[model samples]
Target: EFLFSSLVETSTAAELAEKLRADVSPYWAVHYRFGKSAANLSATALAASSLDALLINVAAPLRYAYLRQQGTEDYRERSIEFLCGIKPENNRLVRAFGKSLQPVDASESQALIQLYREYCERRKCFFCRWGYRFLSLSAR
Candidate 1:
């Protein structure tokens, strides 16, 4: 309920993180204990955990579901925009790509991620935009 509500209300990644921290952290402390976990954790730690859950468990699946249902170029673009708006920094894949380059704005980062997901990870480089360009240059 909270996760769905947060997604509906928040537009940006930072906003989602903040909302998770504010609204979910208290309940998280009580219900989210792991084996032998500390009885008390700082607010920061709880907030981080909540943010991770929202991004990974909630947002990512929702984004993919939207893409599967819509199945159009425009919808794909919108899904990417929605994912990018949600704190790409919190995502390990995005962070790794950021380190490889000097910096990447949200759109560039999302594009790279999309490319990776759709082509690179699938070993479909021949069909990838960058791969196609590289292959064409090599052929020349």
Candidate 2:
């Protein structure tokens, strides 16, 4: 909500950074403690994990969509490169997909997610890479 509300068509990196900084609330820092000891708790305003997840799932995908719509390859490739740079999020879906192939970064993870959602779930084996390979062989 905060990101989309603040984001504009011409938003700059500095502007986005400022919005993130401003959106941070200090109430948690003053009121909350993780454990009996303060040493175990985080005092920072920003949650690194949450931010990383947002960047991977939201920002990168939106960037790819925008770049793809513009019919350009450079920035589209850069967006994928950004995804490839980030670490993959660990979850049941990712783990399930990992049974057959390992995802080295967010790009591979995202690709696997798309494959599962669009092809596997729909049982569109003919459209999937591995599935297509086996299907072609059996058709011969």
Candidate 3:
């Protein structure tokens, strides 16, 4: 928590990445507590996948949301730039969506998940902009 708080206060994405690797690694090494079966982990013990997961799932979303809420276009663009610059995630949903719609990075994958959960799963096609437009055209 201390590492993340310090990391989050940084003014730029590069700083955040640096703090995550440098500061967070030591914190994880000393205080990281996983299940009993898992071995005690050091800074070097953490995998790229774990850090990528944090970047994708937590940092990007929060940054984008805060920028959007504040109505700042430049910061929003920065948030997106940070997201698109990250490595792509490979999971079942990303793979499934990739068959038809390839997600170039973690941001697109997150967008697909949001679309599926918020629109597709709820059957809210009428409320979707593309779906509403398609329906209007079909009716015309």
Clash count per candidate: 2, 0, 0
**Which candidate has the highest lDDT of all?**
3
lDDT of each: 0.59, 0.65, 0.68
Work out the TM-score per prediction.
Answer: 0.49, 0.60, 0.59
Angstrom error of the Cα, residue 96, model 2: value is: 1.4
- Name model 3 segments beyond 4 Å from true: 1-15, 22-43, 65-73, 123-140
Clashing pairs in 1: 13-86, 13-87
lDDT for model 3 comes to: 0.68
Who is ahead in TM-score, 2 or 3? 2
lDDT of 3 by residue, 69-137 (tens): 778768766776777766677777566544666788777877777776787678797997755676798
lDDT of 1 by residue, 6-100 (tens): 66445556676666565445555545464444566545354564565566457756755765765655655555556565433446655644454
